[model samples]
Target chain A: MSSRVEILNDGGYRSDGRRQYELRDIDIDLSQQGTADGCCTITHGLTQVLVTVFGPKEAKMRSQTLHDRAVINVEMNVLPFSTGERRRRARADRRILELAATIKSTFEPVVQTTLYPRSQIDIFVQVLQQDGGLLHACINATTLALISAGIPMTDFVCAVSGGVHSTSPLLDLTTLEENDLPHMTVAVMPRTGKVTLVALETRLHVDRFADIFRLAGDAGQALHKEMKRAVKSRATRLVGAMETGMKPPMGGADAFERDVVMEDKMSF
Target chain B: MISFASFPVPSQNETQGMTRHHPDVEDDIDMDEGFEEGFHRLTSPGEPLTSSQAFMRGHGTYIDNDEVISSVAGTVERVNKLISVRAVRSRYNPEVGDLVVGRITEVQPRRWKVDANSRQDAVLMLSSVNLPGGVQRRKLESDELQMRTFFEEGDLLVAEVQAFFADGAMSLHTRSLRYGKLRNGQLVTVPPALIRRLKSHFLSLPCGVDLILGLNGYIWASKHVKQSEQEGEEAFDAEAVYSNKNDDIDDATRLAISRVSNIIRILAAHFIPLTDTLLLDAYEWAVEQEGDVKDLLQADIGDAMIATIAARD
Candidate 1:
């Protein structure tokens, strides 16, 4: 991860024109899928994640089932076409394994797993398009997918990465931002405001750990608000499907057929 | 889902009096002929929160943390701060009173299942379809079927959200003259939430373009429909709304409209997230100066995307 010329401007703005602890443009699409039990699409800078949840039903695999607690299954895949440069068309790589683990660990504690004992909940997240924060996005998407599925949860898990870039602690680094910054992404549950999952890909000064965690946790909370709002908006629009039969459009055909009313003015 | 009105060009008093509950007339409804085209650059809340904002969405609350707090003190909906209580838990399921537009996915015995971009198939019962004559009530006859065979698989439609059953599936309706199948024109879909709580459907004309906006944030561009309301209080139904009116609107008008649409489509293709106001202003400025236009596209759109488009051009 080169291209990080520590913009020697110290205490100044970082790349992409951000100050210390600044997040990127994080718009979200809460209900991008029609078939999934729950769904959300998160875009962190250029990074995009589409998450779908299928069940709190019977666990598909016998080997993974737990006797008393609801088991969680997390899958994260990076689409080959997501990157700017052409890459392999293979399935999920090693980085995805770590991410899947991060998502599982981050969410397991928050989900009220006791509600559905003997059942397995599956959170499937795909990186439809990728740019940066590949892992962070998967974590956030999983939380949304869980919410959409209406599984019990204590609070939202919001995640963002912060790193030392251009001599500044850059928050929510993009692909370009990540290249130069030695950073770690943190997933936090804002209700408790605690970091449940933290993946530090590069070594950094240990003294500033507290500050980094604080910035990333707050950033995660901000992201949670956005994802939550988007999902609610979509869920509202969805109710349109349920409200049928109220108008009675052609109901009176059996009742009013012979009522004195027939005028064929201009049949064309 | 194309809106036909613009954001309100409110008098100073109207603008000042604007509260969260007292939405502009265009809010929660489509823009008929009554809309104003204008623009205002509103500042974003502190914190570049595109990431955390995503999480805030699910809970019915958003961050004002560390800096920006709630301007509107209401139940915090994590998804959308603008409209509270719409989706924290399910509020209004598909109901008959709601005016909605959807697409046809399957046709069956006396019914069709529509993909309203929802969880399940929205059933369009045969009995819910509106027949032509008001008093001539009869079974949906063969002649009536042939006359209005407007939809099929893949066909887009505009209907109302009617009601739901015990199983949580939706039943849709197309009773009025305004609601029915759509054809000929394009169908642009944004997140449905954007449609439900739009502050204004009127495209701000800070750059001067007549924009017909669907309640769903689907924008239709045409120079012929320039200078605000072309007609007064004349509401356009689904049938007429999708008509290729741009073709008949006039040549110079078509040219301008097409140019604007072209730019927007290109921007959308690039996946440039935009507000209606921002896109119109940017396109106008880019075209106003020919040399600048080239630089503009090149700047935001990487060279590779530009090259891909240029090869086709």
Candidate 2:
């Protein structure tokens, strides 16, 4: 490769100092945003995305209503400052529309739309920052937002990006590595081990696909643990508040300790 | 072969933990034991609850491979052989014989579509309403043409869910004199879960203000109407009931209505369940503070009010 930055060093560390197959740290915030029914903001290292779910309510347009199930509408907006170079994109940008359509199809089979016939569920996704794995973060954030909104879903969809740097398979790649390597994003429903989405933008050797695919699946399970922990804690705090009639402490100390233990268990 | 070093294998303890939480497995230890009343068994989507052979699935749950799994992130509730999960935050789920405040969204030929904060716009049929001439009078064809005269677009009214259509849309009725157009009030919306059912949804305070707590999370606070002026079927004045003009609301009553509305808003922001007793106590607390009605919305003041209420409880 003619790039000045090294994708992988002699010691097996990447440019960001993460070893092969190491995932970026994830931070999730599940807080009420404005009047949305459910909202979530997730950060995968420097990449950040906020998702808000509005309905299961009446459809705005009569033509969009489905007689047997709810219609899912996804709208995505990438802020002009999200990328390294400052640029403005139109509301109907071709790339953004395609991304929104991809997300809508990914969730269609998972959400239990039949429960609310003749209704609509609006999912608004805002991309705050972009590093790499933008699609992965959007999918994960949307899942959390839908859960928080109390929408019925068969399972949680966890996603991660993987790439083959030369012959070594890397998990959760950054923009630098993504530019130099052949990468793909994979979303999995952890419980049933169903692959909901597999998006590949760059070409890769057929032989290398299986290895990266399996690695991404395993990484999704790890990410599932992180998301589950966040959902459980938020649920517990809300239940506690409702029961005791007081504001529950922010992420109780015991909960934080348990998270640490879980993290230790995850690191093989 | 390249070794997959980063991923952790599902350990024995983790697998056991899953089975241990299942209701059927827990049943074996104590046949007579059940979840404590008000105890919340929090669960997330796809978390298996019990074997379908031993329990029946309820709302927020689905049967998959002979197992009952939750489909939302909420508390697990059990009633005898039925298991269900109640989602913490969702759109209002309507039931029969419940009071709701709604705004007219569309005036159809014979029905007025209402925004009841539910999954679909509730239908209010012309036949379900009290005719202007009399309670039992037949509806004339001319009435259908002037539906807007009674409930034009954007008019707010309080009604009860009378029935449901085959498509799950709730039908509302305003046949009773108590249920009709709302005026001289402000509407405040909150999560439906915060409003609970009570003996009477219509509440009056000593401060010359009245409140209608719609189970659909639509709260209306308005000036108190004297019981004597609230006409019965004998003296039903259709002109007054469907009047577009608001009565003369004095500055004192107006201030009290705003104060009570603010209190309700603050309590809802704190996620506290609203009840008649709670509202009365909150109103008294606000008056004792002697601050402007707008001050109750201040973050610190709201926190103080919640803390005060919690301590008293």
Candidate 3:
């Protein structure tokens, strides 16, 4: 109703003070929450999503059990207060169910389900807050949670939202920008640079689609770098804790040299 | 209450520097120094570990285009010609004869589905359990009708992984008297990886607590049951074994059991490998503090407890 708010200002800066291609700050927390096998809380600026993965365990419903491989069940909940308006959405809301279905399909091929036969993998995605990019955050957090749960996945999936504001394409659209622009979310597998998901809800000019898609893909790769670092850092701490007694037979000098190299690379 | 401190701001570079340097200082003189070196050698999912021809792919790994790539984000382990990556946290992968404590989720014909905190519910067949009359008694159709009388839904029991079914679901057997309905205790779960294998999974502490360390990370701490008492009624105690009764546990025994369970919970929260010695050391340290059992969960007290346990090593 209010068309006075500016998404992209005349100065080439977005309303959130980010440049056209700049992404929002990403924060991830993989600490344990309850008895979930693995769980992660991820934030993309104002959007926050917590995903917990349980199983490759027994399926509660025998009818849903797959004989040749594992079954994936994804359930998503958007809190009433997650959006600007405090609106309560039903569990079977069409939009919410579609979102959950899209996420399940995105991860189906990536997860090596055949490795686990006659079991089920449950992914519970909770959207605590949202500005934009809800699907992107959910998909990304699910990927990390699955890895934490030790379910084998072919690769890490990184996602980002991109939109075209008039002629200038924007990366990581916020809710305000999303309302006024034609936006799409893209999820990419960093290892193979394969696009796992490309979700476009708004219609844009045919010529503009290729540009936004390529930009989202490139942004996905950048997101992948940050996500990979967080996962590897946590893995290092845990693996170190498990291997305390077996000090490298060589002197501390060799190990220190290796750490220095790691440090140098990490400095970037 | 949601705290802001829980969400550390978006300083990736600064946080990375801090994390790396903090471990750098601790690795040199820490008892767990070897772990730090190993951590650096860990692999992320999809990272090529080696050629498929040279290394056989194991769990947490897959053969992709003639290259063995990691399928989980964790440390790569090589045994003989087989290579695998072990995720830091995961569901318990049960092996034959491993001890486990599970809660019955459902009761079906001749079989009870037990949630063992694994990838699937482990199967506990009617024949796998000893009937109240005798171990040698035949499992008649009448026994099938009274399956709920044996191990009903929501009943927790201790059993061993009998074998694997055609589908990979583990079949558990509770035929042994020692492996039967669990009572007089509470279950505490931790990450499965933290429970290292020991010669004896059952431990009776001098503090009047009995500990059953299930490899599935389902630990049971209960009031100590004397071995002599067990032997005296060894025969014809099938009724007691199948009984859903909790013998009157005195206040003192209950307190001791709770204290030991709390200690295990604390140890698990810190990701410390739980061994009998470690638990013994932690129990002694907790008693020395002379504080309330609940105080052990406080952050400062928990830190001090971890420090005292580490100091002992």
Candidate 4:
């Protein structure tokens, strides 16, 4: 009501001209950043987040180490300019801490931390821009970063935000639509179709909750395909680069002998 | 050497030739079909590789519902019947006889916790090190008390991965004279996979720099120390090996060290593999520019250097 921009237009389209089930374009970049073991930058329309994963290595703090499993530490920083209105949030802000905790809990079961005993895996999520679906972008980026780091996991966790606008259910609400609607984020492990996380901050009717939750879960599976393709291509490129480097340098007699053997086998 | 001498090459070649001629041989069919050629197909987590009956689950893989599925996104590699996935980028997996450079994180009772960029802090026990004086010396209480004197917290050292502990943590040893506390240079960290196993990891560059390419991606670039001078008359001189002091370094050597270190940083940034020949070629190109060593870090210069190296190859 107070907002001049209509959340839903008369043509059954959102302010962004998207239909009820239309999701934004997703872009994923899984590239090494600095000293991080693995880093990924994901953009869901205007919302962008960069997640960097370090360790499964020595835990810097003795108190944080687990006896039989690795400790997961997630630190999130939301840049002041991330939102439409520039406002800086302190590192220990309650909302930021809550977001970090949500991510940590969501990944706790999926990451096979027991493989690394007494070590720590640090996930640093930096929000460069925020539109709507911020949590979804963060979770998806973290999943890719963890995989690129070679951390073992049960399956890929894909997340999506869904909301119910009046009588109709919407998928991937933007910031404007999110502020006006009752929305929730759902994360699913696509391999088993099991929901890992369902975070809802706003109140919604019992009847509407089921529709949005189910829609978000299905949208997550679609997002999973896109993420899987990105991860697979990245892995392939890296393995190819490594093999090219591993090729025995030319002029070595050892390589010549191997080539001779290959020729002999091929001739037969 | 003796094993090779025992097996005559002519007979081995004849058997290999015969095996190659037989297409019906199921055992050798893999080689004939060229399945071993090229890189293994890559697999993502949750993607099934094969049935559980035919393949054994290895690292980076798991079994679910009688199917061997990959647990990590990586290339699928099979050693006979044991199938595993080798992650493209991962923490260093230390093996026996691997040279590694690590910073001492904590000096415990008789062991030093070294951060070797591995999953866990590598352990350097008092018994594994060659204390000053003699190579074979019994452990002493005083030695235990003065463990920090040998390797204090934050000190970096080059050592060999001697063995593994029960928990799979690596145990490093500085028993040899060549392996000891590092000084007079800087350390450059890169992806461990970039370092290829070679005949000799210790290289004394012609430009007055000594390079120790640790398989763990902790490369030590330092002022060249003559091999004979380092050994000295006393092979186990604790004073020299355990000394915290850095010797006087000339300005030229200092410049060369920075140049080499910068070249390594650029190469690693581009995800290029580091090899002696490739590095030497890069250094030569960098020097040819006659520009400041720091200039090599610039985008244009770095791109040119990698291009020249790739062209030469």
Candidate 5:
């Protein structure tokens, strides 16, 4: 084995010091981004992705509209500096297109697109930083963005990546671990424990597949808890804001300033 | 299964009191009860709201298995036995008779497509608009060729939702004098939820600015036109109404317009619903600060303005 660093240490900790079943720390920001109906910036460890959702509004292209349902158009852009290599990928890059396609398909069954006919829901995913688990971050962020935008969906789709390092399975593998291990990303709708997507690029033993899949699904449930809390708090804050002066000013100025600063940062 | 009967219902007198106040006050009371009974409980997608057998699902909800699962992240509301979730943020859902400000996107054969921030671009049929000479003028073939003169693509106008087509697309009409061709104005977009239906959607401020509060969240702030100069049905001047030229605006009026627009933008950023009283107070606060119109956008000043307004309320 040409692996310079040990994937798992003697203490049963991975290179990032996480245990076999431990996932990366997740950070979610479901704030308004310009005119987007819903927007979310999610970070999993060092991987960061920003997803903005616009519409269920008029379809820009008449041909793309469906007579009985809304069409979802997913456009993804991976910033050249997102990865250590700093390579610029063309808009039509096959891998990027494939990832976008994967995201669109994953959300198709979850979002109740039938509610709005002859309209289009645009999901714009921007990969800000990438260490690993890029797909997981994108899918999770898109889910939150859709929810915040008030797009109806059957359930929240929580995604997490799992890998098999030798016989042991590791959750939320970093770039280094992902490069050297057989990993797969799983997206699950937490309500019914239904698996929406299972994307595997590397080969893994048949027996190991079931274990990682189940582990990823459980991790997705944990992710659902975090996402649900964020959405609930956001809804509560918005409802409170809409209630006008009925309640005392609760973080009104502070929150407004934060939003202004965030908008300024996004402009760059 | 949780029984909703145990929740305290508002008495008849309370409802009467609600009617006596502003219509929006009734909404506030309803929300308060929603909070108390947990009927307006915050729910996320996939959350099981209630048994399908007990309730009929409405918008933002779908029946899955035997339960009515919420399809959106919002507060779950129940009207009698029909349960629905009103999304906190979404595209404008237009209703009949709503005044909206829209920009023309396309001029079709007999209808003009308008970007009204709704699910679909609202259609403004030729028959729904007033002609140049008079209100009751017959449709002429020459007018068909000169549609661009009336409302070319990209012209902003104020209109009312006349009706809806079978596909849920709203049809708009600009037959009223106050409804056509916006000029000497600025359009500021905000979330539709922030605009409450008031006694009147039109307001003329003391600062020489007229405001049109579009229910679709499009606000038009322009130079106030005097009532005497406004054309009536008998003197409908199509040339002036459809004219692309902007009236010469003096510097002070321009300053006031920007200040009003900026104030509206700031209030919207804070997610505060725009009421004439609240806006008047905010404007007064802005004028007292005496900051530059651009400076009103600054974080500190904007925060102070919102703080002052909230305190006053």
Candidate 6:
């Protein structure tokens, strides 16, 4: 596809007329009904991610390692009906493998796995429908799942996939957008505003790396704030349902508590 | 052909936004084909259920007899703050003692979590279950979970409420024969609210055969209780006098009976398909056995169901 510069440009903006650094309309909630430890449903444009968490309990027999740290087990279950026409089941596909591996590696530094030594936490992320910002949606949903599972984390890891289109870098690239261009996913701990993880899948002009990287980090920051409020509110609502004699209430942010909250709030 | 004159258009959200119980709720409760809608009786049988009506205190109190009461009519039993009926009601909440059909979702170590008769997921402890070989135990051994097969995900079970824990969630038991994994039958979930609890789960359909599920919603399919079987039937009239004499009957008991009656009524209306499956299957099986169908029909059914069927046939 040639960069027609005219077809790619409209209203001095993208097809959707979204200014650069502008996020898509996002709908996030826990009000919906679904069976999962913790479930978060996010709709960014048409992209939909249903994230569910299962643990913080004793580790499963298989995943338990001699090391004291809790291992994060992430499984991405994308429904066949998620995409148009039909989508095939993923049986250890490279994409899923890469996704799982990347998530585990990225989250290891954030999740307070040492708190629940020998225990395993299972996070299930499903992309029911994809438009763009799947990595961002995944991170957002994973944050909610972790909160739902009552797992501790250092900060909310908010991420977004972006690409440099016209002269500026785009934020939260959808599949249609990513297909014809270079893409990069940047996950950052919103509170610290540090890029915790970055994956540039396709070739991009070397010089534009700095610019694309900055925009993704900015998207991640914006996303982390949104995800933080969501998790804090969800945790607030879980007050009455807590079985153990109440979790020390989360209100004012202390140093360690803030770090834990931020990490738990951010994920991919 | 169906006539529009007889059929009334249902209102929107007629079933939703039911604020637990609200005054001015005297709209006609279309009894037939209304099990899926959540409703539970909040009153005991023979307990003059009331509705909002401004009556005068003439020589005590009386219904405004002068009013042409066409929009309302049921057994005119109560003339209190509001009017309710003894005919049939629906279930609204999870009662402690009724039998329910539920799905086992999570199998935990000491207890298996079940979707209580609705409302919330309740716990079904190993102690509550009827374990094999009649043994008393607390902790569940790995083998026990395999042998008796307590419950795996997606298993529909019929269990009784042993008790309710502090959280309003119930503790279910399958110790009795009626309580266990449901098999070879279709499941139809009615709102836990609309079931009307009768003293007995045994119901006699217009078709003549009687079915007794227990008050706990457990189904005991059999010919209706013979008139002779109810020969010494204590009239619910007895219950009226009993309730009056025993004002101390805990609110829990009254609430429980109301809930039970409501469940029964909903089941009767909505379980038509379930009943059809049961009867049609049995009828088809008997017909398939070939030999003498008469003997098969007469074998399990008493003379009365036979007589009713013959008459209908």
- The deviation in Å at residue A83 for candidate 4 is 1.7
| Ranked candidates, highest DockQ first | 5, 3, 4, 2, 1, 6
- lDDT tens digits, residue span A126-240, model 6: 8889876677678777765665444445556777888887456777776667777788888887645667788888888888898988878877766655564454344333221
What does the lDDT read for residue A198 in candidate 6?
A: 87
Cα misplacement distance, residue B54 of candidate 2 (Å)? 0.5
Give the per-residue Cα lDDT of candidate 2 at A48. Answer: 99
- State the displacement of the C-alpha of residue A232, model 5, in Å, after optimal TM-score superposition: 0.9
Error of 1 at A208 (Å): 1.3
Off by over 4 Å in 4: A1-3, A246-268, B1-38, B232-234
Put down candidate 3 lDDT per residue, A1-268, tens digits, no spaces.
2457877788989888999999999988887777677889998899999999988888778898888999999999999999989999999999999999999999999999997888889999999999998999999999999998889999999989989977989999899888888899999998788999999988888899899889988888777767777787677666655554222222334334532221111110
Candidate 6: residue B74 Cα off by (Å): 53
Q: Each model's TM-score?
A: 0.45, 0.89, 0.88, 0.88, 0.90, 0.45
The residue ranges of model 6 lying beyond 4 angstroms of the native Cα positions read: A1-11, A32-35, A63-67, A236-268, B1-313
- Tens digits of per-residue lDDT, candidate 6, B1-313, equal 1101111122358425333322234223322323122343222111112222442221111222332121111122233423332211112235677767677777877777775433246688776765544434344466455633546776767677778765445688876543466442223333222233533333333233334343333343322234443313233122221121222334433333323333223223222212322333334333344534224323233223223323432
Q: Best candidate per DockQ, number?
A: 5
> What lDDT tens digits, residue by residue, belong to model 5 across residues A1-268?
2599899988999888888999888888887777888899998899999999999888988877799999999999999999998899999999999999999999999988888899999999999999999999999999999999999999999999999988998999999998899999999999899999999999999999999999999999888978987787678767877776343322334434531221111110
Best of the two (2, 3) by TM-score: 2
Off by over 4 Å in 1: A1-11, A32-34, A239-268, B1-313
Global lDDT scores for all candidate models: 0.54, 0.86, 0.82, 0.84, 0.85, 0.51
Give the winner by DockQ: 2 or 5. Answer: 5
Clashes of each: 72, 0, 5, 0, 0, 48
Most TM-score-accurate candidate: 5
The better-scoring model by lDDT among 2 and 3 is: 2
Note the DockQ of each predicted structure.
0.06, 0.23, 0.27, 0.24, 0.28, 0.01
**In CAPRI terms, where does candidate 2 land?**
incorrect
lDDT of 2 by residue, A1-268 (tens): 6789988899999999999989999988887777788889999999999999999989988998999999999999999999999999998999999999999999999999999999999999999999999999999999999999999999999999999977999999888888989999999999899999999989999999999999999999888878987897678656665665533322234434531122111110
Q: Per-candidate RMSD vs. true structure?
A: 15.8, 11.6, 9.1, 11.0, 11.1, 22.1
In angstroms, the error of model 5 at A111 is 0.9
